[model samples]
Target: MTSRVLYLFGSAAPPVHDIAAVVRTAQNRGFTVCLGLTPTATDWLDPQRTELERLTGYPVRSRYKRPGTADVWPKADVIAFAPATFNSINAWALGITQNFVVGVVAEGIGKGIPMVTMPCVNAAYAAHPQLDRSIETLRGAGIRVLYGEGGFVPNAPGQGRPPAYPWHLLLDAAEQAASTP
Candidate 1:
């Protein structure tokens, strides 16, 4: 296919609410966007499920399909997992594939799928030390993690979400990953 497929996964973070806009932005950048979400994120966006499926031209899948079910989304050329939550990140890094989103990304590592992840976490969670280890683990596995300096910086709890979540940086890294061959 000439157009690369972008598997965009979001967690339960607040920024996931802006996914429709992000899908449009990714489309404008020439990706065929396919959106997936953590189970709670899917519940959070249930009302917009139809619209999101329409927006991305694919089913919004959270739960794993039954055995023998065919995969619906196109083969992903690159994955941009942004607004990943503390729980999702930790679970993903630890190889806990309880959720569909984390399962794909966990397998994406071995599938040779180029991937980018930007965590949307609070300062309290970011300071837990496990977050740092998880980020390093992902990086060691060739996944570009947009955390700490030059990427996403955690905000203080109760301070509200950051106005900008560095979507550009994450998308830029995704673009680069797809082109690396």
Candidate 2:
């Protein structure tokens, strides 16, 4: 069988710092990984950008390409938008595609790709009423969202432990998505 490509998108949350390790783990599971980041995440990881490309064997994309330009990454077999920020989660649900990460997911929904998202938001931001609506919307669309009890529970503001983000559960969900037929 051909390799399964996992398109991993991230936002500017602290867990975004652990993406390199996540990519490595994804690769070990036989996924040909492609990485996309929010603009702020791109800047935050600028120093490791080159190394990330080396690790994934694909450019780390943060913005849209020119209209006539070809897409460099393979077609995604599964998508994981982990470490999703409050803004990205809402934007994606609302079809706000100003950025590449949100744009891909917005379109990805109609393309029938299995997608998963786990927010890295804090308790303070999680309290916003819109967040629950957004999560339901995505889940209503068949996207497997890892939040609340079974998944990520928002930590108190200023108390986030980025290193402890549930990378394993996210990966497991992605693996399941790829295998579901």
Candidate 3:
């Protein structure tokens, strides 16, 4: 069976290259990618969104407005938010779904869907009191937060590479989660 993967992008911290790599790798593994981007991320990546849509064959969205009043949104098998910003993380943990990405995440969480959030905020923001609480809340709500090798950071100088065997690790985790009875 094909797995539907939702790629939620926050700001520029996590690096567009990382997001694109993950999406491409997931696609090669028979997973369909649906991109949900934040306005800041859109600004940072600009035309890359179009390239992503072409690669995934699905429309990319950065707003909360529905496609059509009567149209139903597509449900995803797995929701993965990469480079989640501090604002988005806090909003999501607090049940704020004003945007399309957060809305889908809130709905998915309520439905007991598996979610993986890779936050890419600077060190100071990650250390903030509210941010820590938000991260804890996300964890408390059963969301998987993938911490990169070095740890969470608000802004890294360059696009850091995922650990070796990143795709395999993600695939294994997804498979294990799917196998739960």
Candidate 4:
């Protein structure tokens, strides 16, 4: 069976370093991966777009197509939102689909496709009143949110650096969520 995993990139510190590893790891685990990046995330990965497309055998989409145009990617069996940032997390929870990545994820949730989210916010950001509620809302929608122990935890702001991103954990959580009934 072919498991098509749509990996959505958010503007966070981790994916900038771990995207390649994430793709390779998922592929090794029998997933056919496609990439969708937030506009800012796409800017960060712009130089590697061609290489990343080559790696996944699918184009990296960061923008919506013209109204009459067709989608360039295959139907996704699972959606993985890695390095999900504070802004993206809130935007997604509020059903704001201004960007391609969030739009796809929102629609996927409505369709009841298996979905996973690995947030990469700092402690200050996480403390925002809306953040916790947003997470709870997403979890209520059946999204497997990878947070706290064994997943992502907040760091101190202005640290100027981050610990190793848990890319493997993101894929692992996604795989488990996808296997759920």
Candidate 5:
């Protein structure tokens, strides 16, 4: 069976332009990519959601279903939070499951699934006291939080973009995590 990669997107800079490449890269790696978008991310991706679904052969979800609604997607083999924003990072770390993506992350932790998170916040935001603790907490829980070289490094706040964020790094990390014992 094909491994399912559940990609959770937050409102971060790279995703605004690089999401298609990310999806294609995951598919190339032999994953069935399912997208879970944060509300803000969904708003940003609304124009292309249809195209994205076409590319991945699955729907892009941002909200929870109504009561009695059936889940239409496959169970995730590996879950990745890409372009993980400061808000999303904090929310997930704090156990705040107010949104679909965050809720999935919270549940993924309990499910004992291999998971990876690639944060895309800038230097100033990354410097927040909560961010370090959050990353530490996540790492402590067996979540692979990819940062620094080969992943994301904080750019100066307001500098308007860091050196091209390594979107591919997320795919590699997720695959590795999924395959590990």
Candidate 6:
């Protein structure tokens, strides 16, 4: 069976070209992509979601209510949250399934599937006590949390891209997870 990789989107700033690149790279690596979109993410890349679906030939879900409606929901093997916003992170940490991304993540955790979350928020939010607690909670639960490198640096001229350490590390983790028995 083809290994599945679900991509969850969070509320990041506009222009998610970096995310698009990551998704495209994963797709090229032969992983099926299931996109779960946080509502706020729609503001940055509305049509791109549909475009991603077209490119991957997989379903892109924006809400939890529409899952399994596409006939491929139960086949997921891994779940990854990239560019995870503080709101979505807090909600996931608290078991709040207010949207498709959190709902899928909750299900993945219940099933004991490997999960990876890349948090992309401002430094202040990343340093918040609640955020730390949430990260600890996720770590205790065996979820790999890839904190933004060198603090919360939004996509800027030289800093907005994925951190050098975390990106390859997460990719390696994903490869191992996909190859697992």
In terms of TM-score, which candidate is strongest?
Answer: 2
Which TM-score value belongs to model 5?
0.92
Q: After superposition, how far is residue 16 of candidate 6 from its true place, in Å?
A: 3.6
Better of 1 and 3 by lDDT: 1
By TM-score, highest first, what's the ranking?
2, 1, 5, 4, 6, 3
Which digits, one per residue and each the tens of the lDDT, describe model 3 over residues 68-167?
A: 5652236666676766777888889898876777877877778998877767666666667998788888888888776556334344434444343244
User: Per-residue lDDT of 6-85 in model 5, one digit per residue for the tens?
Assistant: 56455546554568778888887888888888888788788888999899887888888788988878778888888888
Q: Could you list the CA RMSD of all candidates, in the order they appear?
A: 1.1, 0.7, 3.6, 1.7, 1.7, 3.6
Q: Please give the CA lDDT of all the candidate structures.
A: 0.92, 0.95, 0.66, 0.81, 0.81, 0.66
Q: Flag regions of model 6 displaced more than 4 Å.
A: 1-4, 8-10, 13-15, 66-74, 148-168
- Displacement of residue 118 (Cα, Å) in model 4 is 0.6
Window of ten residues with lowest summed lDDT in model 3: 157-166
Q: For residues 61-180, what per-residue lDDT tens digits would candidate 1 score against the true structure?
A: 898889998988889999999889999899989999999999999999999999999999999998999999999999999999999898999999976564587888888999999989
Worst lDDT 10-window in candidate 1: 158-167
For lDDT, the strongest prediction is 2
Which segments of model 4 are wrong by more than 4 Å?
1-3, 160-163
Query: Which residue runs does candidate 2 get wrong by more than 4 Å?
Result: none
Clashes (N, CA, C under 3 Å) per candidate: 0, 0, 6, 0, 0, 1
Residues 45-86 of candidate 6 have per-residue lDDT tens digits of: 776877877775666667655445655544666777766777
**Model 6 — which ten-residue stretch has the worst lDDT?**
150-159
**Candidate no. 4 TM-score:** 0.92
lDDT (Cα) of model 6: 0.66
**Candidate 3 versus the native: TM-score?**
0.78
Instruction: For candidate 4, give the lDDT of residue 58.
Output: 87
